[model samples]
Target chain A: MSELTYRDALNLALKEEMRRDPSVVVFGEDVALYEGSFKVTRGLLAEFGEERVKDTPISENTIVGVAVGAAMGGLRPVAELMTVNFALLAMDQIVNHMAKVRSMFGGQTHLPMVVRMPGGGGSQLGAQHSQSLESYFMHCPGLRIAYPATPADAKGLLKTAIRDPNPVIFLEHELLYNSKGEVPDDPEFLVPFGKANVVREGSDVTVVAYARMTVLALQAATELAKEGISCEVIDLRTLNPLDVETFVASVRKTGRAVVVEECWRTAGLGGDLAHRIHEACFDTLRAPVRRVAGLDVPMPYSREIEKLCIPRVETIAAAVRDVLAASV
Target chain B: METKLRAVLPDHELVKLYEQMVIGREFEEACAEQYTKGHITGFLHLYSGQEAVAVGATAGLHKDDYILSAYREHAQAIVRGAEPKRVMAELFGKATGLCKGKGGSMHLFAPELSFMGGYAIVGGQLPVACGLAFSAKYRQEDRITACFFGDGAVNQGTFHESLNWARLWELPVLFVCENNFYGIGTEVHRSSALPTVHKRTCGYDIPSEKVDGMDVVAVFKAVKYAAEKVRESGRPYFIEATTYRFRGHSMADPAKYRSAAEHEIWKSRDPIPAFARRLLDEGIAAEEELEAIRKRCTATVQDAVTFAEESPWPEDRQIWEDIYV
Candidate 1:
């Protein structure tokens, strides 16, 4: 095992995959000469040369569309969009083409490609930039969505995403880029999709989350442990083929659940998770399923207001306490 | 001015080109007939007036070369060797269709034949075509991607982005614009500042030209030359083929935008008969032989209609499948 930041883990995954497979290529705006705006693609251009690692014009739609074509033409292309907020510009390609091509073309082709974007609302990047649009991707039918919360998962899940025979929307948290954790040194280590991790084991209240919210949920669990409340935290690494069994099983065991998502509350992933939990463990539930989600307003520019918009550790813990308190 | 034509290609191949154009025109006429009879449904865009561009362009490219186009691409795929029966079956939403009825008229795909697809969204296929060419270049394969779009697609941002990327990477791609004058109801002059489609590629430093789309020989010569240049230089080239669509944009529109005088002028230069006249004048094929070719094309399209009528509907379970790998 080696200590690595989430950013470095992603970089290592790209380098290892490029070295292992000659068909693997990376491209995006500023990804080659700029070594990535977040430096996750650092040293890739130097290692793979310009043919494989490319710097493209600022065309988000075409960037993703080209990756779709490249994937159809038998090359594994990993495209970056600088950030997930920019992906809205490419929604036509992302939703209409990338996600629909396989099925639309009658399975004559499969897109073995990954579109990586860093998102989440901690850096105060403002209303347009600070959005977390993971739900938008998860809602799409023909895509696999993966958002890793740790360095190990960042490397493992990214490798899996790169190798999968379908298009993957690999979302990274901008705030988690600098967070360091232990990553397995094995080049072949791959985190499978649809497998939720039990980050913390408890029996009182199950906290289901992923990406940055997973970190906050774990923190809430730790603080709740001091107050004699055991909160089980479930990190859903992959959202599409979501491991509802793990969270449902956790909720069944705990008899209460609180789902947290960094995105807005209305029609967010939290609602989806809560519905699944309610459906699976309705008979065993001692309290109603609660959700700790971001406010339903557009993310603000001010740091103070932005902090309020997203779910915090305190917000998550308080939700857990609410569910636990209502149980008795 | 009547440009005197020389026998640039062999007699047999020239006759074959004439035969393919006849087949395309026959197939499109059948599609229109089928649409009227309610056999083929939903957004049927006929390629009647634009047959030569598809036939000539397809004939000029290698079989291995990739061809991608916009929705009016039944001719493009048929010319590149997609069977008319299966294409008709797709329009009928049958299980034996090109996309197994999942992709109807607007999205026909046969990847094995290197017909990437026919995208419905305007200019959506440009960047994807660039990627296909990029892959060929990266693998050091000597194949060029021929991307066909209508004049309407030039207004899209993807047109500019794809042109710049294709030229920037120096990928081998031939961007063919079928300038049918009107984008549905709106004419090109009202929408575009320059009004000339080929000149738009100048910003990317990609060499381009304009060809008379109604003339099969002109389109063939231009695309053949452009494809060769792209193959040799490993760069993208643009060609704007000035053509007109005889039918409306889709099956819905009546195409009231063009005047009766203008319509008469384009119809007088209809590619299939014009090319046939040239062929007969050049003593390439006898009148009896040309009649035999027309009969054969009609028979081919008739068989396709019969096949589509007999094909079964897709099973209910199939709807759930193909959404993933």
Candidate 2:
């Protein structure tokens, strides 16, 4: 094992997949000679050549749609959207075409494709650039949504997503791309989808989250540990399949749960998780399933306002503290 | 990749094209009758006069080449080797249909034959076609994807986006635009900033051509050359086949947009009989051979209708299956 940043781990995964499968092609604007918008695809063009690693026009719909068609034609295409914000332009292709092609086409065609987009807020990038759309993809069927919370999860889950025989929406946190952690050096290390990692295990309360929010949830768990609050931090690796069993079991033991999501509060993925928890473990709960999400407004540009808009470690700690105060 | 076409597609090929056009025309008319009898119920866009485009271009490609089209695709499906009974059963929402009755009319998919689908949303199939072409190039397969859409679809963002992407990536996609001069009630001039649809593909740097769609031999020649270039270079090409719909866009349309004189002029350009006349005038097929081809087409369509009528409905539980693996 060696320490690698989230971006490096993702890059390594792409390299490994390309070497492993010749059919795996990567394309995006500025993805080729310029490395990448964030250097995630650095050295790829030099290593793989233009045929496998391509720079596409700045058309989001075409980027996504081409990926879909290429996948249908029998290539494993990994398309990179500049950010999740730009993906809105391709929503018709992504939602109506990618998400429904399998089901609507009567299960004959498998969209074995992957769309990677960086989402979430922290750099004061404002509303247009910083947005979390994992919830939107999770709401759609025929697509697997992966939200890796750590570098290891990033590498392992991305490899799995690329190899899976279905269309997958992989959400990466823009803020965590430079964050470093130990990732396995093994080439065959692939994390299966829908399995949540028990980052911190406790019996008092369950804190379930994914992607960037999971890091905050763990930070909150650490701070709460000082006050004798034992919160089990569950990092949901895959957002769509959703490891409902892991969280449900955690909630059953703790009799309480708090769902954290970086997206807005109303109609967010957290709401769906909360509802699932309430329905599954209603009798086991000592308190209502609490949700900590981003503010229900466009992300603000000011650093301070942006900090307030997205959930923070302190907000999560407060929510956990408030839930524990109910004496579960 | 022969652009001039070999021997102008023997008289038999023209006769076969005439038969297909008649079958497509008769099949669409039957769909209207079935809709009245409550056998088919979704939005049905009939392609009564645009037969030459599908029959001509599809006749130009190899069976292994991939195909995708917009909502008005019953004719394209037939030309691309989809059994009419299965397609009709799919339209009828029966279990034995190509999509097991799930796709209705808009979302027809036949993967084994590489007939991907009939997308309902305007310009929806462009990216999927690009992806398919990309895959063929990635796999080093000598295949191209033929994607079809209407003149109204040219104004859509997917049209421009797909063209740029296919050219930028140099994918083997042959975009076939069936410019019927109308999108529902809106005319080509009304919907597009530039009414010349093939010229619109220039922004993407894709090489495009225009042909008289009423002439099946001309369409066949153009598509064959375009498919060859796409396969040879693993790049994209565009062609706009100028044609018209003889009937209304759908069964409910009264077609209040054009005058009767315009309708009569276009009806005179009806591809089926015109191509048939050319074949006879050129000593390609005798009148009796042409009548035999028409009779065969009518009988084949009748057999398809019987097959659709006998097909059963899909089970209720089937709807819950196949959404995922």
Candidate 3:
């Protein structure tokens, strides 16, 4: 194991995958000479050359459509949208082409491809730039969604996503890039999908979250621990192949749950997760499942107001406390 | 005196082209019959009057060249050697279909034949075609991609984006615009800024041409030249085949928007009989031989219908299959 930042771990994953498979190619706006808008593709052009690493025109829809075509033409392509919010421009290609190609074509071909986007509302980038569209992708079938919280998972899950035969929407949080952790150095190391990681083990309450929210949940677990509130923090590695079994089992043991999400509250993924927990562990529950979700509004530009919109460590801890205090 | 077409291809090859066009016409007409009987469901876009574009273009390119098309692609698939019976079964939603009944008329795909797929959304296939060409170039392969769409797709952002991307990368992509003059009910003049579809490629810096789509030989010659230019230059080329569809966009349309005189004018230029006349005049084929070819085509389409009727429905378990690999 080696200590690395979340950004470096992802860059390493891309390098390792490209080195391992010649069929793997990378492209997007500023992905080649510029390294990347976020520098996640740093040193790729130098090592892989222009053929495998290319800087495309600012055509989000075409970027994904070209990736789908390349995947069909027997190349594993990884495309990057500048930000998750820009993925809306490519929704026609993402939902209709990339997701539907394998099944709509009657299993004739598999799209071994990944579309990476860095997103989350924390830095007061305002309404358009800072938005969590995870639930938008989750609503669509025939897609694999991976959002890793820790540097270790950022490397492992991305490697697995690159190697998977299906199309993967690999989401990276904008705020977690600088956070450091011990990542496995094994080039062959791969974290499988549909498995949630228990970042913190406790018996009093189950905290379910992913991406940046997972970090906040872990921090909340640490804060709650001082008050004798043992909270189990579950980092959901992949959403589509959601390991509801892991969280359901945890909720069953704890008898209380708080589902945390950075997206809007209305029809959010938290609603779906909370419903699943209630349906599975209703008989074993001490209280109804609680949710800590982003407020329903376009993100505000002020740092103080922006912090209030998304989930924070204090808010997560409060939700866990609220869930524990309630009785069935 | 030998005709220009006689100099380009042998007698048998010329007859084969006529045969393929006949098969396309017969198959589409059969689909109309089946659709009326409720054997085929969903959007049915027939390639009736535009048979020449598919047949001529398919004949123009190499067998290994990847072909992608819009929803009006039954004729393209058949010309590219997809078994007519299986394609018919696909439309019939039978287990024996090309896509095992998963992809209906709008999404026929046969990878083995290098027939990529038929996209329902207008202009969706353009970028995909560029991608295929990009892949071919990246891997140092010789294959090129031939993408076919209608005039309706020209207004789409993907059409411009794909064209620009293909040229910027200098990928081997032949953009064939089957300008049937209508995007559903809207005429080409009404829908486009510059209704001359071929002229639009100038914005992308890709060389292009317009051909008489009613003349199968003209379409074949233009596509043949354009496809070779793309392959040799490792760049994109565009061709706007000026044709007209005999039917509405799909079965749902009544085609009341088209004038009766315009319809008659295009109908008189029907490629199948026009080509047959050329063949006879050139002494390339006898009248009895042309009749025999038509008979053979009709029989083939009939067999496809029989195969589709007999084919079983896909198993219930299959619904959960193929979403992931």
lDDT leader? 3
* Chain A, model 1: TM: 0.99
* Quality of model 2 by C-alpha lDDT: 0.88
- The residue-by-residue lDDT of candidate 2 on A244-270, one tens digit each, is 999999999999999999998989989
**Candidate 2 ranges with C-alpha deviation above 4 Å:** B1-7
DockQ for the candidates, in order: 0.84, 0.78, 0.88
Between candidates 1 and 2, name the one with more favorable lDDT: 1
- Residue A64, model 3: Cα distance from true site in angstroms: 0.1
Residue B268, candidate 3: Cα error in Å is 0.2
DockQ of 1: 0.84
Candidate 3: regions farther than 4 A off: B1-3
Better of 1 and 3 by TM-score: 3
Q: How do the residues A93-201 of candidate 1 rate in per-residue lDDT, one tens digit apiece?
A: 9999999998988888899999999999978788898898999998999999999999999999999999999999999999999999999999999999989999999
Leading candidate by TM-score: 3
Residues B141-200 of candidate 2: C-alpha lDDT, one tens digit per residue: 888899999887887888888888788778889999999898999998887778988987
* Candidate 1 chain B least-lDDT 10 residues: B1-10
Q: Write the per-residue lDDT of candidate 3 for residues B87-183, one digit (tens) a residue.
A: 9999999999999999999999999999999998899999999999999999898889999999999999999999999999999999999999999
Cα deviation of A106, candidate 2, in Å: 1.5
Pairs with steric clashes in candidate 3: none
